[model samples]
Target: MIIQKVSDAVSIKRSVESGTEEQRSVVKAIIDDVRTRGDEAVKEYTEKFDRTSLSSYLVSAEEVEEAYERVDAELVDIIREAAANIQSFHEKQLHNSWMTTEKNGTILGQKITPLDSVGVYVPGGLAAYPSSVLMNVLPAKVAGVERIVMVSPPGQNGKLPAAVLVAAKEAGVKEIYKVGGAQAIAALAYGTDTIKPVDKIVGPGNIYVALAKREVFGDVDIDMIAGPSEIAILADSTARANEVAADLLSQAEHDERACSVLVTTSETLAEEVASEVLRQLEELPRKEIASKSIQDFGAIYVANSMDEAINTINQLAPEHLEIIVENAMGYIGQIKHAGAIFIGRFSPEPVGDYFAGPNHVLPTNGTARFSSPLNVEDFQKKSSLIVYSEQALRENKDKIAAFARLEGLEAHARAVEERFKS
Candidate 1:
């Protein structure tokens, strides 16, 4: 159904909720088991879920070499080129430690420090993609993380996909494990006999993986409890219906629950894009997935004007937003929420997903309103640097003591007073 007004758009329920309670319980049980049993639990869960038994969980150097042989040389070169682009884009985001000295001898700033290690979870089996390896690993590598550990489910043959291995290797990932699902997340959070615990975990996975991340949040840092992928296209009469339809399908094909939306000022364009979606959906190889997604979560909203369109976009806060209006760049400032805004018609959603330098692991399910796209900062920590001279300390001691005493923190007041006792 096409919505003709903003008020009507509000009433249409979007299926954007997280995992079910039963799924969460199952994930929690697995996590707790792994936390207690370590490799034993991981082995049991891997065999049960992945339908394979593994002697060793680590992806050995021999396996990585064999994976390279199995993959075509051309694909390897493309992954490397993409890696270079990702590295270049993230390099621009690297923040350095800085300190500022004042005349009163107070020095304050922040010290930038990369996490000691990180675990990257790559979805395996049918969902395995080399692009995921590149997107998840490159940022950690760019942030100067020393140890990069990766995990993916082994196939029924008990082997990691060659393309995934090649991508991980190209992205500078040093360690790889055969385990996946909630158990993989568990091993990363609480180290097993073989797998050492990492400081943080980052990547995309299914509902169980999302639940696992949520369960293990405090034990180890996670990128985000990522929801299903989503996209919104803000288009006008000038935008091509075919291009808009293709862009919407790109996200819809990822998952059946993925949201594909179009908010346009032109009702004619809205109807044209909806028809175009149906035409293209028939041609897609993943037509079953894409078609179901469009029928279930897809929407076309006709706004009164461009201002109304922009307002609707902000409310949705889609993981990916494509602005295909007459002056796409000019509308950028009006977009208050969106994980990544793709300006102009040529910049499709996949460009950000695979080729473009921006991280594809983005905030989803209205999270773009507050959170951000995964970047080098996710793999790093910052500590406030404060070096106060005697003069500075004395000058601020009275105020500090007064504030502390007001909060009933006498100990805190006394600590400051002790420094000035002499």
Candidate 2:
């Protein structure tokens, strides 16, 4: 069972901020090795870590076609529908190249351009999920990224999962490699003979992948250092105990470190939900993982009032938040921090995770306080546009020079003054 005391909030926050020194050292070594050795390092690491050897790293066209044949026709249709929903939602986030001219002939705006290419790292092992393929690839595709390079570890059979390959093909991924872990990230950051360097890398992975992303951030942009999945439900007396318990378990099953929190004003509801979570855990296939997550990081806060519950939610700043109280929409304005807010009991987190049209690749580990979910903006680069007419330049040159000189850069001041010379 989860902790009941309010002070457990501190423990929850601490649990999310985890990265050992040994993990960093190992990831750094892998990154440096890949930087120097290129495909050779990648190959060696793939054999050592993934326990699969291959003559070639690239997934062939025949393999992709076979994947389509292998997966069930019904699931294929559902993936296509999910792809359509994702594309529709992300298209709305697309930004147009905009500019404006002032009366003084100064043109200022932003030019939004999509990155040339992006590498998506889909975790293999027990964490492989086809939904991640759709979430990472669709946004880049919608933003007009020309090339989408996908990398995932081969299973024991030396092949990518059929469902994952089918999803990548459905999402318009043109290039794919059967390699994973930190080595794939390094190859993406610094080009290998087989895998060309990409402008940015996106998707979720294990700790090694997360650390590798952190290490190579300066070389190539990354989506975010995503943490374990978490959910915080702010329910009141009206909320159903079983539904809330099931929702909490939804995220808890993601990993042993995943967190599930419930903040409610009703003590009786808390007791009911706690009992339901234990009862339901027995039937889940991933009960061992979920149980460990609950015992370590899960919690329920018995707030005295709705105000206290809102405070608790903001303090936690959970990745996925469910507000099941009365007039859920009415409390939306009051919620200050959360990656995604599921407003009613009917709107569970899975709805957002799958066919709900919103991007499910969200900020985790309380990053919702400042960052945002992955959207079209993540794939697009913005440049400030400034064009000053001769008159405008003449009017502002002295002021610009004065400001530059104040910063002890005489060359900057002189450059502006030289432009006005006779």
Candidate 3:
């Protein structure tokens, strides 16, 4: 990892990627084909990309049970516990539909309603992200979204991972499809012969999948276009070098474009963490990938003071941030950005990623400046509730008409005034 002065944050601003023209053209063609030919197009693309052929895409209950058998019983138990934790956390975020009556007899409030349906696309390739299954599905379940459908690319053998199946079963997902890539996104956005279109789509995928999500966004809601994973650790001299290095590497192993950076007040700690990162990178299973990530995007900044370090972090607006300073809790109010904040050394980024109960689906790039993590609210719609008494409407009708007229909406003004005329 290279060391730099904190003023050099320009180099660390961001590197969000948009798909190439070729990729976008490919995604558009697939989405159009899926819209035109439906299930047939999905299967054709699945065979081309995943090298698997299937008469049916839905995973059967029998196959789910078989998946449980293939996966270790102990891991299944862990998935259940993780699901429970996620459910419990999101349940706290749930708000009921409410209405309130004022002294004037006007009833007003907001109605909270879950989406009619949702589709979650899980990427399948070098690894199985059962955690993603739990993360995406459990929140929708907690928000009371019905018909949560899951789709993942099947292996060359035409099977989703046992752990993924087990996780979905545990998360209460009834519909699982063996389709992925841009085609799956298309099927989810527009109804296919087999897959019903959903109100919203959420999950992470490759550039093709990301582009597909972007293309279909106006028709159906989507989670943000997730860029590579990012972790920014703000440490002080009190922070342990090895632990900081390890936490940074955790995100690096996710992708070659993943970013890991450390901003610290202590010069010695900066040098030590830089050394520790390289030393630990040698031991990672995804060393080649992590090494490249660290080499290309990782850095250490020696700030003149802790305040400078914190300011630099806010400017970056990282997706995941860890404050390992001496008085970490005291700095919470000062943090203006970050999708998720891990305070102190005890709470590593992975804790929130898996067992800790926060959604791992977060805004990437500098979007944390204005966006948020996936939550129960994302799966629910808010409708303004109004039960206007005749007296209340009578009092406000003129003002409402005048306001509408000010906007040059004559019909809107008449709509409000008509209630009062004669």
Candidate 4:
């Protein structure tokens, strides 16, 4: 990892803008093909990319039942435990439609309605993540989504992973599909003859999936435009170098493009953490991926003061921010933007990724400044409710008509006027 002083803003921008031209063109072509060809296109891509031919996209109930038996009993129990925690956390976010009426018969309030149907895309290949199944589906279920459709790429042998099936069953998914990648996203967004269209789609995938989701945003609501996973650790003199290095590597191992950064006031701590990262990298199974991630995207920014370190973190808007300083709580208010904040030495990013109740599907790149983690609210919509009595309309009609006419909307003025004519 490169160590740099926190004074060069131009270098920071260049370092972070890692997007490529090829990614854009590939995603555009896939999206267009899926939009035009629908189910046939999805199947072709599935066969070509995943190397699996499917007569049907939907995973059968028997497959799910068999998956339950194939998975170890102990692991199934653990999935159940994790599912319970996820369900409990999201239940707290449940909201009811409400209205307030006055004596004058004016009713005004907001109505919260769950989406009719939702689709979740789970990546396959080496990036099969069952934890994503729990994070995406449980919230939709809690929000009372009528139908929950899941899509994942099949392995070379043409079967869904047992763990993925088990998690889907535990989270109460309505259906599961074997199709994956941008084609799967298209099948969910535009709806083929086989797959029903969904109101919203959520979950994470590779660049193709991300770009497909971005392209399909207007057709169906999506969770967010997620980028590669990233972590930024804010450590101080009190933080253990080994612990900080391990946490950084946890996200780094995700992909070659994933970013792992450390910001600290202590130069000694930074040097020690860098050395520890090198030592640990040699033992990791995905060391090649982690090494490239650290060598290219990773950095240790040496700030002159703790306040400067906090400011630098805000600017980066990392997906995960760990404050391993002496008084982690004291610096909580200083953090303005982060998908999730882990405080103190013991809290690592992986805890939230797997066992923690909070959703792990977080905003990546620099999107944490505006986007948020996936939750029940993402599966719900709010509609404004307004009921005006004849008398209420009579009282406000002139004002409403005048405002509309001022805006050059004569039809709006006439509509308001006609309401009170009788």
Candidate 5:
């Protein structure tokens, strides 16, 4: 890892990767075909990309049972516990429809309603991501979304990952489909013979999946167009070099484009962590990926002061910010623009990624400056409520009409005015 001054933090430039024109053309064609041909197009694309052909895309109960048999009992127990944690955490985010009436007999408030249905797309057919299942589904379930559908590509043997199946089942998803890629997103957005269209779609996928989501955005809602994983640690002299190095590599191992940075006031700590990162890279299973990430996007910045270091972190607006300083909590108020904030050495990035209660699906590529982690609100919609009494309408008709006329909406003005006509 190379070191630089905090002010000159140029190596870790963040940019969202839009697919090539060829990839976009392919994704658009797949979406259009699926919209027109429905299940037939989905099946063709699934066979082409996933190497699996399915008579019906829906996963059978027998297949789910088989998945449980493949996974260890202890691991199932763990998945259940994690789901419970996720559910409990998101339950706090739930809000009820509320209305307030004033003395003037006017009712004004907001009605909170959960989406009728949601589709969650889990990536990779051969590998399992039980955590992704729990993270994507549990919040929607907690928000009272009745129909939660899951879609993942199946492997060559026409079987989805056993652990992914177990996780979906554990997360209270009654509907699971073995279809993926741009076709799966299109099916979710536009409905098919076997699969029903959902109000919104959430979860991460490959470039084709991302582009399909981008294409179908107007017809249905989607989660963020997630960039590569990122972690920026704001550490001081008290932070451990090996632990800091390990946390940085945790994100780096995710993808070659994944970014890992450490901003520290201590130059010595910066040097030690850079060396430790290289030493630890050799032992990781995804050594090549991590090494390249560390080489290309990773950085160790030496800040002159704690304030400067904190400012650097805020400027980066990292997806995951770990304050590994001695008093991490005290500086949290000053540090803003992070998708998720992890305090102290004990609270690493993976803690929230896996077993921790918070949603790991977060804004990436400096989008944290505006966006937030996935939560219950994303699964619900709010409609403004207004019940104006006859007297109230008579009193506010002039103001309302004037406001509408100000916007050059004469029809809107007339509609409100006619409601109050003698």
Candidate 6:
């Protein structure tokens, strides 16, 4: 990893943008195939990529039961514990539609309604993540979403992961599908004969899935386009270099593209953390991938002060941020952008990923500046209510008419005028 002093590093623009031409073209192709070929296209893509053949895309009830038996009882208990925490946290975000009536017999209020149905995509290849299922489905359930449809790729045996199935059952998912990749996204967006169309889609997948979601966006709502996982650590002289190295490696192990950065004021701490990372990397199971990531996108910066470190962090807007300083609380309000903040050494990023009650699905690649972590609001819509009694309309008609006329919208003025013609 390259080490730079805060003053010497150049200000670089973010890597991801709205949509590149190649991305648009890929998305368009996926959308077109799904639109025209439908189920056939989905099946072909599944066979080609997932290496599994499925007679039916939907997972059967018997399959879910079998999955429970296949998984360890101990892991099942852990999943339930995690689900409860995730549910409790999201339940707090649930909003009720409310209204207020005036003496003039006019009522005005906003209505909060959950989407009728939503599709969640779970990546299923190489590794299975039951934690992702909990993070994605719990919020939708808290928002009272009517139907939760889950889609994941099948293994070589042409079956879903037992842990994934167990998590889905615990999360109250209505349906599970044995499909994955961009094809699964297409099936959800345009609706295969088997998989019903959804109002919105959530969860994470590979580049193909991301591109597919980008393709199907207008037809159905989607969570933010996730980039590679990233984490930034802001540590001081007092911080534990070993712990900082471990946290950085946790994110780097995600993929070769994942970014891990450390911004610290202590040169000694920087050298210690770097040495610790090299030592720990040798012991990691995914050492090859993590090593590549650290050699590439990973960075270590020795800032002049905490303020300079914070400024560098804001510029990066990493997906996960850890503040391991003596006064971590005092710096919380100063963090302007981060997908999630872990204050102090005890609060590692994995805690939030598994059981901390906060949603783990977060914006990536500097999107934290504008977007937010996934929550109940992602599955719900709000509509404004406006009411004007005759007295109220008459009282404000001239003002409204004048405003509309001033904007060259005579028809808008006419609509209000004709309503109160006397």
Global lDDT of each candidate = 0.90, 0.91, 0.93, 0.88, 0.91, 0.90
TM agreement with the true structure for every prediction: 0.97, 0.97, 0.98, 0.95, 0.97, 0.96
Q: What's the true lDDT of residue 410 in model 2?
A: 99
How would you encode candidate 5's per-residue C-alpha lDDT over 1-422 as one tens digit per residue? 88899777664665466999999999999989988999889888888888877787889999999999999999999999989988999999988889999888999999999999999999985457889999999999999999999999888889889999999998888899999899999999999999999999999988888888999998999987998899999999999999999999999998898999999999999999988998999999999999989988888899999999888888899999999998789998998899999999899999999898999999999999999999999999999999989889888889999999999999999998997576
Residue 253 shift from truth in candidate 2, angstroms: 0.9
lDDT of 1 by residue, 187-253 (tens): 9999999999999999988889988988889989999988788999999999998898899999999
* Cα shift from native, residue 235, model 3 (Å): 0.3
Tens digits of per-residue lDDT for model 4 on 1-422? 77887775334421333347888787778878987888888888989999989888889999999999999999999999999998899899888989999888899999998999999999899655789999999999999899999999999888999999999999888689999888888889988889989989898887788888888899999998777789999998999988999999998898888889999999999899999999999999999999999988888999999988999999999899999998799999999999999998888988898887899988887788998889999999999999999888888889999999999999999998986566
Checking candidate 6 for backbone clashes, the offending pairs are none
lDDT of 6 by residue, 1-422 (tens): 66789898886323353466786676677668877888898888778877777788888899999999999999999999999999999999887899898887677999998899999999998899999999999999999899999999999899988999999999998699998877788889888788889999999988878888877888899997998899999999999999999999999899888889999999999999999999999999999999998998788999998999999999988899999999899999999999999999899999998988899999998889999999999999999998879987888889999999999999999999998676
TM-score of 2: 0.97
Backbone collision count in every prediction? 0, 0, 0, 0, 0, 0
lDDT of 2 by residue, 60-134 (tens): 999999998999999999999999999999999988999999888999999999999999999899655889999
User: Candidate 3 lDDT, tens digit per residue, 1-422?
Assistant: 88899876576845566978998999999999999999989989999999989989999999999999999989999999988998899899999999899877899999999999999999899899999999999999999998999999999998999999999999999999999999999999999989999999999999999999999999999988999999999999999999999999999999999989899999899899989998999898999999989988888998998789889999889999999998899999999999999999899999999998889999889899999999999999999998989989888998998999999999999998888789
**Model 6 clashing-pair count:** 0
Tell me model 3's lDDT, rounded to 2 decimals: 0.93
For model 2, which pairs clash?
A: none
Which has the higher lDDT value, candidate number 2 or candidate number 4? 2
lDDT of model 4 at residue 97? 88
Determine the C-alpha RMSD for candidate 5 after optimal superposition of all C-alphas.
1.4
Model 3's number of clashes is 0
